[model samples]
Target: MSNAKRALQTEDLTKIEVFSDPQLSPDGNFYSYVSTKANDKDDYNSQLFVQSLNGDTPVQWTFGDVKNSNLRYSPDGKKAVFQSTRSGLPQLWLLPTEGGEARQLTTFKNGASNPTWSKDGKFIFFHASLDKDDDIQNQKEASKEERQKEQEDKKKQPLIVNRLKYKSDSSGFHDNKRVQLISLNLESNTFTQLTNNDADHGFQDVSPDGKQVLFAANLNENADYELSNDLFLLDLQSKEYKKLTDGNGGYHSASFSPSGDKVVSFGDEYEYAGATLTEIYVFDLASGERTCLSKSWDMQLGDLMIGDTRMGQSETGPVWSKDESSLFFIATDYGATGLYKVSLNKELTTLYKEDNHVFGFSYDQDKEAFVLGISSATNPCDFYYLKNDGTLTKLTKSNDAFLNEVAIAEPETLSVKAEDGKEIQGWLLKPYGFTEGKKYPFVLEIHGGPHAMYGQTFFFEMQLLAAKGYVVLYTNPRGSHGYGQEFVDACRSDYGGGDYKDLMTAVDYVLENYSFIDEDRLGVTGGSYGGFMTNWIVGHTNRFKAAVTQRSISNWLSFYGVSDIGFFFNKWEHGLNLLDDPAKLWEISPLRYAENVETPLLILHGELDFRCPVEQGEQLFITLKHLRKEVEFVRFPGANHELSRSGKPAMRQERLNHICRWFEEYL
Candidate 1:
């Protein structure tokens, strides 16, 4: 392996291409997907591609440097509409399936994305942020002079906030704009706004008969404080809407049945807030009753956990069976994300179980087949056709050129009992050029979200660390998904408690079994929640020689007001609001124990990170520096919380350099 090709480097990320957003055509004869690759400028670019059902190389349907995504074929299957950034702002673009030059469709000033086709193909539905009082005419034909005036006006005006949530981690300051669901009449060349709410309305699926459109919206009075949304159906003719969900839980992934009489929903009752396991539900349109189909399945549905390497946007569809007897959806179980089949009568079946990640899939009802976007630890992701009998046929190799040039280390999956005897799952990646008996440095990699799981998905950061001759260890601790509801809710209100112990136990088990690990040369690093744990670990114990925390929380008290979700997330995870108990928030915070930290710590954060906020890192850095503890802080200027995963290429490479340098120097 060593002589065949070199190991992966930080810059190799540019060569790593990804394919996602698999969409089945109306005739079940073609499957469309999005492919992303680095442009000559080193910035990432995505394009749309389609392949025939008879196993052929996918035809690149769209071209140019700009990104083209959110693809959906028309009802006639002759044309496709997608979102692209070719117009400076992401707008709708139309392309012919037969092949031709793609043409621009919508030219909205705020941009249009996530395009969905109406059953009749007369109109296309999409989501876009529009000014509160602005309509279709106000956006498209706006003069360039007017836009220039608005930009100058913004420069001369003061920034204002009028809503409970004014900014988010994904998009910066949310002005007076609201993301609403709208329909574009292809024939009339006019736009119809279906939703007029202050909150965001995400379009899900349209009815088979094209009478209604299904969508999810958190229409509560205080949606910012509550983690709940209701499934609603909009009348296409009358332009009226009716709520389906009780607005108790955060229901999402709502899709109509083939008969259009019911909708299959994927979400939880918020039994454990954000950590609650996702369940499949069937809501009858006529009776207005919802049935929980996977109440007893005990596994989380869909991919909630995150990895450092995953690219491309994949569609989430709870596709109805041709006969409408069952619903198929994605399930994150253990180390694999696979397709799950659940019947209306509560019967459950593992449709496509594999030790890999099923990021997305498209069902071909007529052909009784599916095109799944699947990948393993060694593969990024590609389209695979799954026949009715459960056989998989590879469709694309977007990353083959890069993967073939670099050797990837497959980690050894291991299971061990935690401090409480509850089993924990983890993996250990040996350093490149590893020897049987040579001792080597080990780094315990913690994942963020404490709720997010680490499993079969490929992680670029972990592989890069392994390539640099550092054994990388990552595990799904107590609060991680893929496990049951109880296991996921274990870490709530007990942050840095059982979850921390489970991680420490995972490390102890690896060290004891893997005799080649140098116990004293141990190091730890994590981002977000993992960052919180790294901070907690250093403060509580000095076992590790060095630590790096990225976009982590240092003090919950201040975090409650700064982070984008800080206001409500604290209440959900810790069961304590700022007014309820400020002391407990600080008690669990790593900043409270800042004086106890002695490990040489390196802090990495994005200045624009409103999730954990750079302030969280600032407090920790200042506190440790004043205490005379060895520490350094590196902040990225225009980056966000997702810097490590999808930030600028240059910044990502520099981040990796800082991480390697800190670990190399201290450990």
Candidate 2:
């Protein structure tokens, strides 16, 4: 195939679309969701669209240059409440379901997000950090002055803050003040602060009756150990709060049942030395008892999924049917992650199973139907509906026009045994217009999280590489979630050992089994922990001809003081404090072995990335340059660790283009 034709066929990365946050109307006549589309500017813009069950052109509920997300329909289905930054900072907005102008609800300088409507539809509750009273502002200014004085006193003073945690990924700099829940009265135009404590409260869900609120909070005095967030209940009538679960381990996503007699939540009781597997639990309010629903079911399919698609585990709680007889949830099992339905009486049945992953879903108990958002290695997310009799119908064809103009590669599932004889799972994508005998250059892509799993989801970077005529191989190694707690925790204190070996084994298996792979022209690249592994791989061996590391940790010694999670992560993974044993930390750092790197490398990072920090990339780039090695550095302005997922749309596109360009030039 000609290069232009090949490019047209394989360059489907720009055409891929993502859909999320599906909400079914109360009457089950309409559904609303957030659909992200790429514009002429090559930037992704999110808008809210509502459509009927009979498949019609969706009515655009929102229009603007800004992104709209987190759409939720009120109980009466007369209006919709969502969080948007269209007015600059993210705040709550109320829009009529029948199509009308949206009105701003909350006004806060810091920001407002995660808006949930009360059961009675009389008030809207949200979380915000707008407690800047006069005394608090004065204290903050005094603290800033003290820090400036300390910095001026020493020529080379280390970066230190009085806060418990130095940095967070998206929102840098930890403040001591707590995050409170506030409810806004629509009629009175007044706000009432709900929880008035110093502790942080989040993941709130209002009960069906609107008389009580279910949420997760850390009530302990020790802020350091606040990682053990637990489920709590707040009485709106009496203005009292009570703990529902013991705060021994972290708990989140507390949702109420249809009858409001029980609450369902997910968290790890104790696994992998407190890493938390995020199993499902159902709490009976009247009996004051909690039952582990996930444990009762066969775990042979693996750990249950929890949380939304953006953060936390990909698995979420089961949505209770209208009558509270059956629960529908999503899980990754039997090689693919899809939606499942579990009967409260004890029978488990698979509702809908597809080749791709189901990120988020909503069910309408009144109609006995559900609207789901599903995606796979080759297909971007799209909307679908499952009827009561098990009939599946496609709702929206958002990418039909884009997909017709671009050639896309299909991903094939591949499995290999690790060095220790454990089974590993992964997928491989061949270049568009691939031939049978011709050998093609290959790239091994690693995923971040050291705890996150790369499942059957459409990834833009992987497709972009395939379009450039490179075979893309990605896998969930030993430390990845979705398998089990023990498997994910195995990488702790052994960052460069088993995980590195598993990746190498995957590479060897592909080269040996696939005849179309070229061994001489090999490249490796990854971000975060994957980036850390790429650095480690290059330092230990010179097999790869080229490498690219994004937001990686080069030297643990420097990272201990720079990155936001440096102090805690170093201890959690290495099991050693920075002050006690700096040597062990250094040994695990990728920069310590930079002398062995001979292959050309490109380091990419975001300047505002506090999670891995730009300094980590700088350390690797500067050290490689000083050692007389070929290296290139690319820094994104005002981007954070989420640059690949939800960062600025233009920047995200540039990042993908840069990675593809580097590989095309070097390999």
lDDT top scorer: 1
Residue 236 lDDT (model 2)? 87
Give the Å shift of residue 529 in candidate 2: 0.6
Candidate 2 lDDT by residue in tens digits, 242-265:
898887776776689878998877
Model 1: per-residue Cα lDDT at residue 517: 92
Q: Once model 1 is optimally superposed onto the true structure by TM-score, how far is the C-alpha of residue 390 displaced, in angstroms? A: 1.7
Please give each candidate's TM-score.
0.97, 0.90
- Each prediction's number of clashing residue pairs: 0, 4
What lDDT is reached at residue 530 by model 1? 94
Put down candidate 1 lDDT per residue, 374-458, tens digits, no spaces.
8788888778889999888887877888888898988789897988887898888988888888999989999999788888878
User: Over the full model, what C-alpha lDDT does candidate 2 score relative to the true structure?
Assistant: 0.77
Candidate 2 clashes between residue pairs 3 or more apart in a chain or in different chains: 9-407, 305-315, 305-316, 306-315
Please report, in order, the local distance difference test score of every candidate based on alpha carbons: 0.86, 0.77
Candidate 1 runs further than 4 Å off: 1-3, 141-155
